[model samples]
Target: MLQRKTTKLINKHLLMSLVVVAFASTSLELAYAQKNQTATKKKSSDISLTSDDKIFLELREASKNNEASKAKDLGQKLSNYDIADYVAYFQIKPRLFDKGGAPRAETMADDAVDQFLKKYDGTALADRLRNDWLLVLGKRKDWPTFDREYAQFVLDDDTQVKCYALQSRLTKGESVNVLAAEVKNILLDSRYFGDACPDLVNSIYKANGFSKHEVATFSRMAVENNFETLANRFDVPDPMADIVRSARKSPEVAFRDFDKKAWRTSKENTAAAWGSVGQYLAKKLDPNGLKAFKMQHELGHHHLLTPETQEWKVRAALREGDWRIVKETIDHMTPSVRKRDPAWTYWHARAQKELGDESLAKESLQALSDQYHFYGQLAREDLGMKIHVPKRVAADESLVKQASSNKAFARAVRFYDMGLRFEGNREWNWELRNLSDKQLIAVAEHAKRIGLYDRAVNTADRTKLEHDFSLRYPTPFKESLAPIAGSIGLDTNWAYGLIRQESRFIMNARSHVGASGLMQVMPATAKYVAKKIGMNSFKPSQLDDMKVNLTLGSNYLNMVLQDLDGSWALASAAYNAGPGRPKMWREKLPRVVEGAIFAETIPFNETRGYVKNVLANASYYTAMSSNKTPSLKQNLGTVSPKASVLSELP
Candidate 1:
């Protein structure tokens, strides 16, 4: 019995030992597997591969194949992934809920709302989404959320006028008050939005209940729009008076009507009757004569009209030294009329001097300084003699005094006034190169107040020492830029450097191609950026505001930086051209170094030159200012893949 019991115990112990060993081996295998899995996950995360990552990959593939349906599906998936992923959300939402097909009203509404909430920071993108939402929702008043959003929407000038007009009709309210205010605003702010006045004026007229002033305003606008029938309704003095006045001031008129015989024959007829003169001139003048006449018109002199013969008659007075005729002409001339003629520069100076008004004479001479080349260089030389260029004032003592003194605002204004005067005289360019840092700051501050942000930025940039270009780089904003810069992982120096180069820091700077604000951002670009930032109701005007411009600009810079594989140099280059071009450039030059070779080889002269200037400016700024400059070469790595795609052709 004892032997049998011992045998059973031995068997049990062996079985138990085997079980323990098996368990240990299994545990070790599980641990190893988990470790490998974690490592794999870390690798994938490092490469930005999440479950939703395939959506982007698929979308790209779909785009490559031009597979709209697949792209739309993937886009929807990406958009629905997370609200915080603005880029993906904006990218996918539009495709998912396209406007062309039977509109997925609910989907579009949600997408727009998502876009708005994400980019609520007042970006151009946000405004676009909001506009989109309003457009899609139409007159549907049931959606309280849409109504609420609309109520808070920051309507642009055109939209505001339209909204007011619509509200007046919907609510049975008088639009005259709103129309009047808008008309006045339009007139005052005409330069802000050029050539869009007719549409706005028409919208105002269409609104309910028009007043006499509104009628008159509409009549004038009608004439401007070439709707002569509507324009002739209001029996105001010949509706063509303003046009005649405009034509009279135009230089082309003078050249066309140069024939004294034609003028003597047509003197009795109305000004509009002189349209024949333009036709005659067009027939008679050669291309060069026509070109010269057009150039003169652009120069803002109008010597064409029969009614203005008296003004020209005064020119003869000056030529013949007939002071009595000059005095008589001056007496009869309106200030507006007096201001138009370049001969006034000479006449005004002579008259002021003869009248023994030394101060007035000096003022006239200063005004005529710019006209020196057109009239004669004598006036400018005389003015230069009297007004010695102001010495460069030290910023340390003078700045503090100017900043604190009651005259601080006044002094800054005076500096700007002088700057303008210099600009008018074409002297600012030379004077700017010699300005003290203190003077530049003062001028910049003054420009900010007067809405000349671009000039201020330029002045600051020009005054900055080439070496210390980055130091204390002036921004239009007083605060909040650092946080924005941080959010986008951008070097403030680089940002400031770009701002300086792009617009010379001008808030209202616009390019001939329709870019606006300090960054010279295109409207379409601003719209995209605004939507990306989720600013639901951004107006284009807000771009002029420093904070908005910087925030959007920084975000855009960040996007470009990422797209260019973290190369600041390439990013800067891409910023000038689009990312696709840079990507192509990098692909084509895969063996080259980023900064030295690829950047140097960029095809677009404008972009290549721009990149070099920006980089140099940034380096200088970083050195002078406290900011650290990142290495252009270090940040952007060596070229990698020889992309089969086309080289980024700038």
Candidate 2:
């Protein structure tokens, strides 16, 4: 029942299940057998519980429903439960919201939390409970208990918590200037880090830790990034904040309005404000705005341009293929700004090459080629070197045995076997914190032996001295993939490359947006492809079937590939970020641009990265499959607005 275009692909052959490369001789079946055996040997004998266990479930349900009388009744019947910590947590959690005044509620919550922490001090749930307790203490303004509990709180990256901690320090007459850098970082972050962060920013400004000029700089930055709520709270005057807000909808009017008020502020501050609006226009894909702004206005010397302004200047020039201007903008940036990010460093070298300064460009590329990243691969390509992948080293029995015996690793394995991957990955990564490079390699090898391909790839990436290409860039479903790709006239390496980036060989990996299976196809996309290919009675659930999913995914990819005129770079971007977005991005180009520059200028951060990684992965896969060096430049061929004859290929 396949459509004419797809019938030949399906009729070509049977499914192949054997993998091509063998980093470890352990097959998927053998790994599953090992997991089953381990589970059988280690499973606790007393899994089923007595009638008393029903009380625990009742208490949990009562707590969830916020039923105070039901919880109170269940609490009296739970004294004999073996899980004393959980029982205590379930009893106290609902009561933390008690309306009987703040101090009394906090004291009750604190006592219950302290008891749980005392009993289960090292467990993950204890830390989770402590966060709830800290929130109560923060609300009650009990700085003493809040400080003590906050100090003991691990994983302290919560922005709101840090803001409260700062409030406590400031209340005690501590100089906020001592934490100036940290304050700026947390305050300026784009995400709404909750009310506490804005409250902390207001506190710091009132405390004179942030000067008027500093406050204005942050406001301008907020407006440039279209964070209006943040811009409004920076104490900028209502009229000026209004002008900044207008930049999003009317950049030209915003720029003119900003100019009229230029003489009211200091020259440097005025430049900063002007730069913010200009950057906004550039980011909005206004082709002439940035170039005209630079030509007509005085931004002082190159070194005096704000980091934000310089970044937009470089981006605008790169978008228009003006290499000289790109080099000039980068040269004006501070050494720290230019040197910190590999993206800027790579672009500086690229500009140098286009400007016929190969000596300097070569030096920059040479230094960057040694690292592993999107830019590093580009640097390697610029230097005419193949992507260097280290030889696969087999794991020794002794190393494997040692890794299996490690307590934390064993806990992770047990968690994975119990279908608790979230907990398993957490335990696994947490244990990796203090491991030596050699120990990490051994642990990665053990993960590979157990068919934890995702863990194996991630863990192997951590090693400094040793490198293993086969483990890092594995082709897990080669037998099923190769013939299907060939039958469809698609590059097997390219298909594998896209799949590896999409799911990392995790068959059941579901994205946050519900993209499922090996190729991460959405249910709607699957249905459409299924119907288009004359597949009858197609159930959405068939997306989980490996062959069906690959058939639909590869066909969709090939369709996109042809529609975009055989440009893998565009097709890769199209696959991740839809076909419409890349077309719009291409239209923004003043003229046909190099694929690298086009990729670097993609407005969506995720899609930009997706295109680069997929192409780079395809290049490496090509090298591995053909046993010859693949040209990264050829892989990322120049993208143009016009379609090619390949678009007509059927």
Candidate 3:
């Protein structure tokens, strides 16, 4: 009798669960109708919490703190949960990743890993499992299983795994040239690739893949790419590697080292030695660098000039505004180096214009005007054209409705509301991955309607068939922004532009470094700005509020602008980095140069990109808001030494 009563209760609850999902489905339709619906409503709450949710939360915390035994106990209680796969994963994670006091991961059965991958298939959890499983396989030198599993791996960004895959291929007697090309790219890039890349190359060397000449070529590539530290590691035939090393440490010492070598018959060694010295001199922008090049030319060793030395020569000339020399150097540049960026294209045109070659300059400018970048905008200005934001592309309502109904995106919206932005983005991107161009626009519109401005912009950026300027350059939070910017004497469009880049209009967005809200004001910065502006009763929590964030952010921007002598370029750099850095960087330049050149030469990768994007974004916003094209050059002006400006603020 008790068993029958329990059965009836289970059936009643099952019916309730179905009704909840049905209600959620109906609410999603309402969400479609009201674009401004709170992202968290119905979807998460509709799924009634059970003991499993509590246990799962506890298990997650335990795993995070590495309380393996505690996690195991909590995880056991979640064995029958709807996301039991995740619980199982947490149960196994510590064993796989932990080094000290952990049991052998190789003991894990192949069926165990295969089961997780097979069940989860397309989920982020599966991708994570693959990574962990691959690591264990690599640790055990189990190449066969790795090879089999690697084919199904998505997100091929793990450099170590890539290196291991290459090792497996080599062990199978396969040529690594195809992957070697990829490796070379990783090596030459400015980003760190960790130990795996060097390890792979070392393995290749042991396998007799790299000849002395090949190693020398790689070393040169490293030096040219400004990866001097990496270049030092290459096992090139002695004195040449030594010269590359000395080039970074002391160009004078490198020149002395080159001078010590007697170059009568060894032309290759001579070229290597002289090229290293020349590169060092050019890198320092030493006045003697050009003289060193002339000396090499006089001695018929100009052919020894590599792309590195040639490019630095262009930078040095650009600093001095030596247009004739700039054009000559550019003309002499290798096609690969000359065509590396549109900056060179713009410079090529400028050089032609400076040298009284208007026709040639016009041709170069015309080619560059079609692009949509810093140089592209400048090129358009050079061609006497206005920079206009492209028209909005209207997505089909049916397509948008379909996108709104995407199960993954719906779940993502719920996750975002739960403050699980990482997971939410993963789900959101998974849905975006296979979408058609039109579908992409539709989803972007859907994301926009739901207040996911960042997702909207990113999605619109991916569409190849459609160009949507309004979607890409959205002006959100005007109600809070306009008054704050106006009262602070800041350009409303510029303030909006900076905020767009800073937080992507996410109201509660917090950066990894603890910047919060739409403006991404750091806690200390918030306090400082509030104090300076005489804002009493300021609380750090208030930084997350829209109005307070804009108020503090605009005041700080105005401060930097005033401090930096009203140069927007310097001010933008100061805003992203700090006030001190832009000041120091300005001191590095002895004379005035165009703000574009100043921006490009910034040493910090993040700050350099930040300044350009903010300025370009500001230009677009200005044009969009005012319905008149603003000159990007006028915004950039020139960045000069603080001393050059008489009676400037300290």
Candidate 4:
């Protein structure tokens, strides 16, 4: 019985030993697999191609054949590779297109359309192609083809309205009155083009007979366009002339009472407010006084409105016995304000101490124990005495030097102001090139002094070639942009043009509406795209990094291009407006035409001119940027009116 029991115990021990060995072996195998996986991941992440890679091999084959078609095919296949591949593809596409001619290129495009339509039917590309087809049909003046295609594709009301107008133009001789009514209907539709009502009204007058009301409307447009001579033709005093005079007398009150409605209803009031301020300042100060005050005020706004600024302001005010401004400044303090305004608290404590409020002053001083304010530490040390020394933040000397020499930076500021002016008035194609280099440089320096760094950088870059100094192109990232154009299938000249128009290639470029980075991406859009591309960890600050910004911007642009059916015109429009608006316009093509006619009839001057300017710019850019310089006929497409059309008409 004892021998049997001992045998049983030995068997149990053997089983336990086998279990431990098995666990150890399994863990070792798992570790080996994990290491192998890590190696594979690293290889995949490299993105750099070797000589033996399929794309490189295909490129080699295409090179030997001297067959442009084969080369083009290989190039397209390699487009999924890194930026190097994209550059190679871009270089090859033009060569292939040049060699094969339009027919061959068109065939390839058609094949691509077919393949993409079949594979990604519901995607942005499919919609884009459909829109392109519609545009082509419209350009060809093939209304039947356009109508047939328009039926297949979904279009937004705005596009529909435009389509209808085009159709009406085509069928004008058949029933002039009917077509005119159609145009008028489109003009009245708010969804199609609510902003262009005035233009539509003028069109209506021309189509029928010009009346006194129509002449008045045309004169108002002239006035809005800054054509004082033409505007003077409507000699009737502005209905709100008295209101404008009243507002001029009380400029501050006018500014305070300014709202969207008031500005829209009374141009005289707006002119009065803006002109009055200039006149008042002119009277109050010397010739240079207004300019100097503007510079000083802008600088003060930048440096004195921040929490740190507020702290400094309060301290300075307390010392100068100017409590009113200090109190007004600190009234709407945020948490960031409290944290950054240690100097403010310190000065507040001093004020209390001066008032013989020892207890409150002591409490304020004690509060600084855990904080790291500029004046907090000093306040703690000088709690019992009057705090007099002001801590000054040093300006970056290199940055200041660069800013001072940057002419492009100055131009950007001027252009920005010009844009604002253009927004208020309906001026068209006001080019920045008209300004002198000296003026641009001065503006750049002024922007820098006022903390408009992005504008300063833009202006500086634009004036770089003209200036002999290296200070204009001080940013290292500017040098890195050479490879960016080719990588994105853009010509260097065109890229420069676009950048000049966009952000002047300033990596830290930001729009007033919170668009950030070189391409001015909105935060939400950036985040969405980053995640879509598996860059889940992208931070908002990365948008300011040149390489990252270019990569993401190119990707976003590709997406937009795809969405807009490869029409750079529509893509540019979508970039300005949201993609949804453009998409809706495309979907409701007929309705959109009506809406556009309606928009033309709109009394709102701003939107009327905005659409026209954007369209005109897009047309110009498209013609200028195409591989071949498009003919005037090609540029304007079917919309090009006959030489005598306008003259022969009304």
Write down the TM-score of every candidate.
Answer: 0.33, 0.75, 0.74, 0.27
Clashes of 1: 24
lDDT (C-alpha, whole model) for all candidates? 0.44, 0.66, 0.67, 0.39
Model 1 agreement with the true structure over 1-650: per-residue lDDT tens digits: 00000001123222110000000001012211221111001113224455665565566556445355666667777655532333343454454334442223454346546655575635433544555455344333324555555665553323333343343343444455565454543432222222223334444555533433444433443433344554554433233334433333443564444433234422322222233223222222212223332332333223222223334334334333445545545655444456544555566666667666778778877776542122233355445532111233334545534534433244333433322222121222323334466765565455455655543444444443321112224555536667898876788767766765565554444443445455555555566678887987988767666678777777777777765566777777666666555565565442444353344345553554456556645654554455453343343345554453322111
C-alpha RMSD between model 3 and the true structure: 13.3
Error of 4 at 525 (Å): 1.1
Candidate 2: regions farther than 4 A off: 1-108, 115-156, 160-178, 185-188, 203-207, 219-239, 250-273, 292-297, 300-313, 322-341, 352-363, 402-422, 512-514, 531-537, 643-650
After superposing candidate 3 on the true structure, give the runs of residues whose Cα lies further than 4 Å from its correct spot: 1-74, 80-82, 92-95, 98-109, 135-144, 168-182, 189-195, 206-209, 213-317, 320-368, 644-650
Candidate 3: tens digits of C-alpha lDDT, residues 1-650: 00000001123222110000000011012212221212222235435555666577677767656566777888878767866677887776655655342224555446767877888898877887787677667666689888887887886656567777887887787876665655544443323433445556766766677655545655565665566676666666334656666776798877766676636535655665565576567555564555455445445433334555666666656766768767876786656567765667888899999889999999999998866667778889989998877666788899999988888889777656655555576677767777787788889899999999877877776775566767777888888788888887899888876776666677775544456677767787788778878998999989767899889888888987887889899988777766656676787675888898788666554566567778887888888788667888999999887642221111
**Over the stretch 1-650, how does candidate 4's per-residue lDDT look in tens digits?**
00000001123222110000000001012211221111101113323445434454466446444456666666666665543422253333333233322112233344444454466454332444555444444444566655655665643334443644445354554454554445433332222232233333344455553343333433433332334454454433234333334433653443345433444643433432333332333222222223322332333322112222233333333323434434443443334454433545655665566667789778887786333222333454545432121222233455457545554344433323422211111111112234455544554455556654433444433442233112222223445655764666643332332333344344444443456555556666677667766788899778767777766655565566565455443343344444443343344222222222222212222222223233333333333344443221121121111121011000
Residue ranges of candidate 4 with Cα displaced over 4 Å: 1-479, 488-495, 587-650
Model 1 misplacement above 4 A = 1-425, 430-472, 539-541, 624-630, 641-650
Query: RMSD of model 1, in Å?
Result: 27.1
Better of 2 and 4 by TM-score: 2
Model 2 Cα displacement at 332 (Å)?
7.0
Judge candidate 2 against the unseen true structure and give its global Cα lDDT, from 0 to 1: 0.66
Rank order by TM-score, top first?
2, 3, 1, 4
Whole-model lDDT, model 3? 0.67
Q: Which of 1 and 4 is the better model by TM-score?
A: 1
